[model samples]
Target: MTSTAGYDVERIRSQFPILQRELKGKPLVYFDNAATSQKPQVVIDALVEYYSMYNANIHRGIHTLAEEATAAYEATREAVRAFIGAPSTEEIIFTRGTTEGINLVAYSWGRANILEGDEIIISSLEHHSNIVPWQMLAAEKGAVLKVIPINAHGEILLEEYYKLLNPRTKLVSVVHASNSLGVINPVKVIIDAAHAVGAVVMIDGAQSTVHLDINVQELDCDFFAFSGHKLYAPTGVGALYGKRELLEAMPPFHGGGEMIKEVRFDGTTYNDLPYKFEAGTPNIADTVAMKAALEFINGIGKENIRRHENDLLQYGTEQLRQIPGIQIKGDVAEKVSVISFVAEGIHPQDLGVLLDQQGIAVRTGSHCTMPLMQCLNITGTTRASFAAYNTKEEIDRLVAGLHKAIKILR
Candidate 1:
């Protein structure tokens, strides 16, 4: 509710109830934060409060419950608008998650604007969600899909990206950070380069929103999408931030109750910016609960969280580098709190199973970026992603688990 001037880590950790839970007689070491963060009691409580006290459909109802529910729902929008530093609340559109958000952009903007012989640009580090929707759109629109290749360290080649951008480029959809490699792209630079050639840019902020400071106005990105679940909120709720002019220009993604101004047998008129994108009933409780999650992060300070998690990344990277046969994936210096690695003679699945037996939860697989793995010449990597709640002690446990697993596997 206020500026995150003085962050308190311990106080913040105390708010998350799952952090206090034990798994198989040991405290849960939740290093799989990149997948979905554990929700705080405050966010959980918000869900309870909404369902228990004010349960009603919002916007159109006039009953007392509807009024209260509407206020709570609208508050979450304001919270999201403030969280991303959006120009206006109208610019923030609710979606299921990043996947749905990207799809919305593709269907609405890409389908409408993209033409034959036009090009759509994305990087090699994109999640399948980012890649598939654009490819589908490009195919449907008869537009060409151009990929900005990543170097050995998994960082996008800026020169290659710039060279790919020209008058033919209609849209540039890039991830703000890689979910698998943990590489944070120079999105502002990318956006500027795309704009120089008159292409609209959409940034998939699913990974970046949690750790980095975001000022959408400052970045001047045309569209920004992120999932609430990745940012310590409930799943099934996320937001899409678009510049007002662009959102106003684009057609509605879906046709339904809340998104319409009027419905006639022959034709229908759409509502304003955000409501036009959010069709039908939304994830009401989870959407309302997201404000509490954003408040929790705001209380802790995103910059402070970034500092702590970056420290964890550095510590985990160095410790894993010392292990025999262990190789870190994507040695990009600019990264978030995610560390993905592989061990010689050990499958990532086996490593994950062994780590879980020791109460160290980690993710191992393609991690929703199968193409990225193919590019890296690997099937998958065992990924341990950190949050503000994670600590050096947890990193030590991870390292210990890896050492024991390595000895047995070898």
Candidate 2:
């Protein structure tokens, strides 16, 4: 359970107050990071300060308070643009979360570009957010939704994906990292192949943004989306990064106050770039906090944090493998810090309940990936995900709790 030296795991743990509390008189072990990471103090403080000090609607402001609030909100857009390595701030659009971001693209871009008899490519491992959006859009547009098959290990079959690409393929959206199984897909290659056919690619980065270094420009992806809560920020805030030319071509997602350039009885023109997509009064406090979360990651250095988490994942995988009768899912070389497994003769829900009794938190059930669970012919799995604040000792505690839970269930 010893952490690697040079990284102060103890000091890092102190930043999160929830980690300090005990569950059922035992030290709480949180491993449901894929669901939502616990926010750091800096992000929390930014939220409090924004509400306490400057709370006003952004854009079209004249007074000092409105100007300060507008600057803060716009600064978050710049931070998001930098965070994803987007080409311009105009390409960054704030949304409720990844779900809304995908839907925005589905409704706007999908409806505009995809016509009848066209195909939309997606993988079998996609979460419902990724799958359902395209499905709904395809049904609306009369376009066929084609699924890229995955192998037994839950990794996408790239050869099959390449074959699926044709002139009829209009859009390709895939998860950068699987939430249910921790598999990291070859997004760069996927994007490249999709672009070869002139089809636009959108990466659902809900899980990968926190664990991996994202360079949207380098990735050459048409669209990228991620949630703030999963990246140590508050909920109800997320961003969608699109290419400038593509964003300009698509229509606005929601029409309201700031999104419009001028309003008349005849018609109205939308605002430029991002504001056109961000309609109504936005999530001011959470948007400000998201910038702080990005700054916190930069302060710690994403590469160093990723290295530590990878080590934890390796250690956890090895330790979990030693436990008898444990069926590990998605044990592939290319993966993030997600592990899903099922104990023989034990239901996943039962295992989660037993682990929680020992102050350990793990996710059970389909994890919003019913199709992925069905692909593996299992009802669900017990998922344990890692984050920057996680330590080696936490993994040890998790393994110990899993063993005890298995024994109790048996």
Q: Which digits, one per residue and each the tens of the lDDT, describe model 2 over residues 279-371?
A: 899998899899999998888888888888899999999999999999789999999999999888899999999999989899999999999
Q: Name the 10 consecutive residues with the lowest summed lDDT in model 2.
A: 1-10
User: Runs in model 2 with CA error above 4 Å?
Assistant: none
Best by lDDT: 2
For 1-410, candidate 1 gives per-residue lDDT tens digits of 12124545567678888888887788889999999999889899999999999999998999999999989999999999999999899999989999999999999988889999999999999999999999998888889999999887798999999889899999999999899979999999999999999999999999999999888999999999999999989999999999998999999889899999999999999998789988888889999999999998898778788887887899889999999899999877899989999899789999999888888999999999998898889999999999988878888989998989878778
How high is the lDDT of residue 8 in model 1? 53
Global CA lDDT of candidate 2, please? 0.92
For each candidate in turn, the TM-score is 0.97, 0.99
